[model samples]
Target chain A: MDYVLTTNALCKNYRHFKALNGFSMHVPKGAIYGFVGKNGAGKTTLIRLICGLQEPTAGDYTLYGINNTDKKIKDSRRRIGAVVETPSIYLNMTAEENLKEQYRILGLPSFADIPELLKLVGLEDTGRKKAKNFSLGMRQRLGIAIALCGDPDFLVLDEPINGLDPQGIIEVRELILKLNRQKQITVLISSHILDELSRLATHYGFIDKGRLVKEISARDLENACRKCIRLEVSDMKVFTRVMDSLRLEYHVLSDTQADIFTKETITRLVLSLAKEGCEVLSLTERDESLESYYVSLIGGTEHE
Target chain B: MNKLLSANFTRLKKDVFLKLCIIFMFAIGALLPVLDYHVMITYEFPRYIDESFFSYTSFMVILFSAFCSLFIGTEYSDGTIRNKLIVGHKRMDIYLSNLTACIIAGVIMCIAYLIPYLLTGIPLLGFFIVDNISTIWIFLGCNLVLLIALAAIFTLVSMLNQNKALSAVICILGLFVLLMLGAMIEDGLNQPEYFEDYAYMDPETKELVIEPSTANPYYIRGTQRQIYEFLSDFLPGSQIIRLSAMDAPSPEILAMYSGIIAVATTSLGIFFFGKEDIK
Candidate 1:
């Protein structure tokens, strides 16, 4: 795969605490790479290192094949636009004014793209509204607009959908999808919102304790997630005894609920439960979602 | 660097706080001479335009303190500094561009005061009455350099600190402390070496009694006096006071001190700012 970003054992230390410890990952070109980690899991730290907001204590990363230590790395960075932690924008300026300031910073020849950029972020109709007065969603969109100013092919966003209403979340989600699909801009999104991430990410990197637990494509992850039949029974002991006697692959989720990973006939299982005097309250086939996959992969508190 | 500077200047044009400072300086500039002219008429004494000419130095110091802190602090508070960094601008360039913008603002504030002061004062009072034309030139040169030094100091404070409110408080409070220190040093330096001996009629004895002169304990002399003199020229607050009174013993030395301060603070600021981690 052609990679736009690749890291080799990157590390960041804040005084005595290590935020990122020998963490590494690869983001393929034109792929929406979901950076998944619980809070304090070094997701933001990695983004900061890549965005040049903070320097790593050890190792290095390459942007567009340019090593970070190389003098020409800055030129490679010019192809990236990032909103690390929060949207970096001038709140006192209007949305249009903010873009113009960014344009000036990027040294674009003119302000011609300002309107098109605003419209792309759904902020064009906000004629004279200063960013300070913008809603959380509007501000976030404006931040994305600012990130999109120089027509960068790679975009990095840290918790882009955080603290938004449902409508706002949907808007931002649609916007991200549009950017990825239509513009083909490679996006590296660091978020703990797995369900939202699942909808957009083509590939994912699950992180825990400042290290990458796994990096898998969405297709591989989908195939890896087991299809199980969730069963709620009256007598948990009887159900376990029968499952043990049958030697079925199973996981106990609760006292009365269990997941059987094997493909068993419903009639036989029901008859066996009936003969054991255990009532089957419900049984349903379910696919393990990204949330459950993350939980199983990291195996800590849910969402940490 | 040029792109960052152009962007910074664009933001500088819309900064309301800076505009307010400029207007306030101009108003104070125009009013100072008018008030001194009133004093001249009411008290029946001559007051030269030169007396109030450099009076804007103190106000300029305060305004620059407030302006630089807010101006640079806004970048950190609003997170806009990251925009520049992520767009491939070097941290050194960002620091230098901010310093340049602040220095320009300071110079503009000086001009704002000068335009009104010159327009109002010269017609009412008169041209500079100093012994030589060079003194005025010297004062102007020293004051301009002093402004740059002050801008550098405040920019250093604001750039190193990420908190806008805290930086503003520190810069403003820091200005007052320096001003007070300068005033105290100047006061100590101004003390007479000895009290003059005097003869006075004793009310009880009705006889003239002569008293011997005594040395002033507050008088700063020797190496201590030299240190005080250097500080009075070195500190921006002291430079303002000295320039205002037109009593700079050596304007060349004052300008040199200002140059040193500008270079030192800027070097220190850029070094630390380069190491700072932006969120």
Candidate 2:
């Protein structure tokens, strides 16, 4: 019932371009909200607006029950830390120094927590190596460490795993989970990489062209994206005839295609189709992923 | 153990621009007197000596005013500002911190910037060398503060724009306009019409004469009398802070009160700048 973030008809325009067009979303407290969208779908724009980098042209948003326009919004913002698009770290500074600079900027009393925060991000051993010399994963962790300087309860990360190698990706992924699990930090992560998002998200909101198509919990999404057997046949009428005769649970997709939800062996189904005088063209199995589910919601042809 | 890292050596902990400005200030500061000597020995040009500051405060002020905007503007242009703001900081804090850094960097400029120039005047200037060293020092100190104040004000302005080059252009143009406006206002106030003299003085006698007539008995010269009167109530530093880079105060020992006023005024600007949002 407690929502950490809520937006109502939030809109933003850059010249004639609509960066956020009536975007509305709710992030429940303590939930890892995965903001699923393609590139240029207003994820970063919305993050920027929420972070106060830019103001919304119309509508309202609330953080921790405090409205964006309230005087206490500053105090509310203190609870949220974001890495917008890329980690903003001073490449010339060491990870420790970067954390200290951030702490000073946030007006925290002292640097007592610097080492521990760096340790939390797994950048503790990076003693005097400047951030510029850091590996991509190290830089990202340092950036996250900088975000953690104020002890924020909510973390907003934009493409946090972008451009990382496999090992680096795994490191960052683990770090996010650790922070969220141990510290109880609610995370709002925006990423185009849905497979990875599916690995970490507790909840999801799919956006296309600045409008949220669906907002669903992971458990519900799993049920909606259930696995099924896809079939390509010589004739759909015959395919449906055999399926209807068998009383199987299925869907007729096209003249040449159909999908069955029932667990039937391929050889048995092949013989069954043959008896109905329908030849099997091709058969494939599909365990629906977030990407396909998104495609199902807002259909689009393959991009890559 | 954290204290093992020396705070002085903790210079590593500051912004690159702030560090570069300080380093540039001292380097220039150390080289100034020697450069002045080079100019004097080779070119036989007269050198001006001001001891109130480290050395070359004017040159430092000019450099700070021209370059500080670029440093602030670069962050906005590269979208680095978004990284800072997203970390739970209000936009106002971003502006204020950068502004404070700029002005404090200005003070550093005051110390190291003038000492070298002051040393160049080692022996003394000849008769032709207009020797108002004390007043010039006072003026330089205040002028440097004013320059930093201007830099602080421009930091907020520069961040208003997204393009670094355009922001730099607008800031320079804006500073020039303010400087000109301050000058024009002061000049207009100083230039009084004699014929339109105040009530206490007789109009016929005190009126500035445009023509040789019995009606207009007095002819105004330039702006000295009015300037002299304004000079009594106002410090040369206050006038300099106003913008047009007013004429230096009458020859006298530069006092701490004027320096305090200059620091106070410049500090106010930095304070306002610190609290403004970047975008």
Candidate 3:
């Protein structure tokens, strides 16, 4: 498969703190790759390095098959647009003025596209409003517009929806989806909001403690996170033995609760457990969520 | 000031402080000369530091340096350096953009100091100078030294610190250090002490040559009739052009002073500052 980004044994260290340790991932072409990690898991650091803001302490990363140290890497970067953490907009400049500045930064031929780009980000009517006075959501949209100045096909957004209200979040989400689908731009987004991430991700890369825990496509992830029977019983040991006798795959969630990963014969199974003198207090079936899948994959506590 | 400079120039245009600083320097620079004219009409003279480029330029340079450092250094401590790189600008371009602003700020301040000095100090010359051309050269020489020294020292301070308050304090201290160090270098080198002259010391292998008298190397032969002191050799801090203007500095010595302080320090600043990582 064609990949937009590939990192091998990438590492970065700040004094005694190891921000990214041997991190590696393959971001496929034309995919909305969701970079899921807890805060301070080196998400921003990796973005910074890939963006050329810093040099990696060890290993390397490649963009569009061009190695970072190669002459073509600079050319490759021109095809990328990124909003790392916060918006990079010049606060004192107006939105149009900011876009003009970005055009110069990218060495573009003209500022003629400023109107269309601003309209795309919903800022076309914001005549002469300096970015400093912009609302957070407006500023964020302007930031996205700034990133889109060079018409780059690859976009990197770090926590783009963070610190926004629900309506603002939806606005950003719809914009990103439209860009990916209509404009055909590949995107790499990092956010702690799993549900929001799941809504837009075509593929997933789970990171923890400076290492990539897993990388799964959306369809495969949906299949892996299945609808299972959640049973609250009096004795988990007896329930476990019964489940083992049934030859079913299950996991004990707590002292009195467990999950049975099967869709068939639920009534029959409960009767069987009752016959075996196991008291089933409450039995319910539900679909697994992205949060639960992430927890189970990394073996965190029962309550997220 | 053309489009080729547009790359770095846009960065400055967005920054209000830099813009305001330029206006501030111009207003003050334009006024100092006029103010000095008023002082001169009463037959009064300012102190060497106030009147000399070293004192006046040093003061303004320290101020300009603080402004530049805060404007540039805040980005580093705040992690905004990453955003600039992500926008596709190389480290070198970012460095150059900032350094241009610093040098430009220095030039503005230099212009500020010169206007008033020429408008006022020129008339009070009272026959000390033989011609207008010589007086202009003297002003040019002093102005070059002032801009060069201040730009170098301020660039160094900006690179070292990121906090606005701390950087300002450090820049202020840097000026003091520059003056003190220049004094130390002058004092230690000009004292003509001989190693073999001490009775307790053994003979020396190197030739033991001594000058006859103790005055600055610049003070060659002095007479009461002269308007200012005459020197045999150039002293680094000694004024190349005095207000009295009776004795004009030779072209060779003027070039040497301008080259040593202005050219040397400015280039060194550009070299180091060009390579500095904004973060």
Candidate 4:
């Protein structure tokens, strides 16, 4: 797989506390990789280490094939833009002024792309409004705009939708989607809001207790948490017989309940059960959500 | 580094606090001479225009420190420093760029005070009253060195602190403490070696009374005096106090000390800042 970012046994220790312990993951190129973890589960720690905000205690990572220990890693970082934990921006400057300042920091040649980047982030009209006076969402968008100063190909956002109103969250969500889809910019978004993350992420890295528990593509995750038909029948033996004859995949929950993995026609199911002397009591179509799949995979609730 | 310096300069141009501080210094510059002019006209007292103008060095230290603190503190408060690091600029470059910007700011502030004072004082009072033109130039040079050293010290304090308000307080308080120490040392160094004796008619005794002379307490007589004199020359604060009198005989040594202070503080500041896990 073509990965824009890859980590190998990356570790970060803060005195006695290990923030990231042997954590590893991959963010494929052009993929909006969702970094899923509970609070303090090393999601932000990994982001910080990667963004050069903090150093890792041991091991290393590569960005655009440049190793972290290499001096040229700084050059590699030119391809990355990150808003870690909070939006790193100058609050005293207006949105336009802030972008211009970031351009200056990045040593960009001109201010020509300022308006376009602002427009892309839906902040083109925030003229003359200093970032301190901006709403939380506006500030978040402005932070993203600052990160996009040099037109970086890879973006890393630490809790991008955090503390946003519903409207704000939707706006940010749409913006991330647009950036991924239209611009083909790869993104590494660390967020605990799995439901929202599920909507945007083409890949996921589930982290727990400073380690990566799993790394799964959206397609595989969907398959593992796919839709199923739940059935309640009069007899388990007859239902098993009917399922076996029909060659359908299922999980038996109780003596009388079974969940069929395939999408079978209701009439055909009933007929097949009837011929096997199985009386159908009730059936309900259900799909395993990302949240439930995560809970089941990690053997705990999201709150954990 | 050039880009960072230019960016800082851009910010400095728009900084309202800096602008206000410069304006305040200019006001003091213009007003002090005007007040001296009033004193000269009304009381017919002899006054030196150059002295009145150069006296601003004392207050300019505090003003310069306060401005540098606010200017550098804003980076931490606004998380703008992270922006530079994120863009691949070295930490050393950021620290030095800020130091350079603050140095430039300090110079501008001094000029703001100097220009008005020179324009008003040279015409109102006289051209030079220190006897020698070189003495006046040496004093100006001493003030410049002291300003750079002060800028470096304030930058170290301000950048090391993550809290803006706390850094501001530390920068101002630090300058005030140094100023007080400098004044104390300068006062001690000015003490006379001997005390005078007096004989007078006692009011109560109705006879002549004699009081014996004792050594001046503030006067130094040993190696402690050497240490004090070295400190007076070495410290930027003491240098400012001494230069205010326009009698810095070895202004070159003071400039060297200032250079050392600037280099030492800047090196330490950059090292510490490089280790800082910028949030």
**lDDT of residue B46 for candidate 4:** 78
Least accurate stretch of 10 residues (summed lDDT) in model 4 chain A?
A295-304
| Candidate rank order under lDDT | 1, 4, 3, 2
Q: Compute the lDDT of residue A263 as modeled in candidate 1.
A: 92
What does candidate 3's lDDT look like per residue over A1-304, in tens digits? 9999999889988888988999999999999999998888888888878888667889899999999878678788888988888887767678998888777767778999999999888899999888889988888898889888889888999999999989889989999999999999999999989999999999999988778889999987876677888889988888999988988888788999887887659778988799889999998886878998888777678325
Ranking by TM-score: 4, 1, 3, 2
lDDT agreement of model 4 with the native: 0.87
- Candidate 2 Cα RMSD (Å): 9.6
Q: TM-score, chain A, per candidate?
A: 0.82, 0.82, 0.82, 0.85
Model 1 lDDT tens row, B183-226: 99889889999999999999999999999999988888899999
lDDT of 2 by residue, A120-186 (tens): 8888899989987998888888878877878889999989999999998998889899989999999
Better of 1 and 3 by TM-score: 1
Candidate 3 CAPRI grade: incorrect
Q: What is the number of residue pairs that collide in model 4? A: 0
| Better candidate by TM-score, 2 or 4 | 4
lDDT, candidate 2, B1-279, per-residue tens: 122122212333355655676678767766655666668788998664432233343345455665657666656653556655664454555555566555656666566555543454454432223355454455555555455445555665665656788877776676556545545545554553554433354487995545432333333345854564454324432344342233445422223434454456545644654443344
> Which wins on DockQ, candidate 3 or candidate 4?
4
TM-score for candidate 3 (chain B): 0.55
lDDT for model 3, please: 0.70
Q: Pick the DockQ winner.
A: 1
Q: Estimate the overall C-alpha local distance difference test score of candidate 1.
A: 0.91
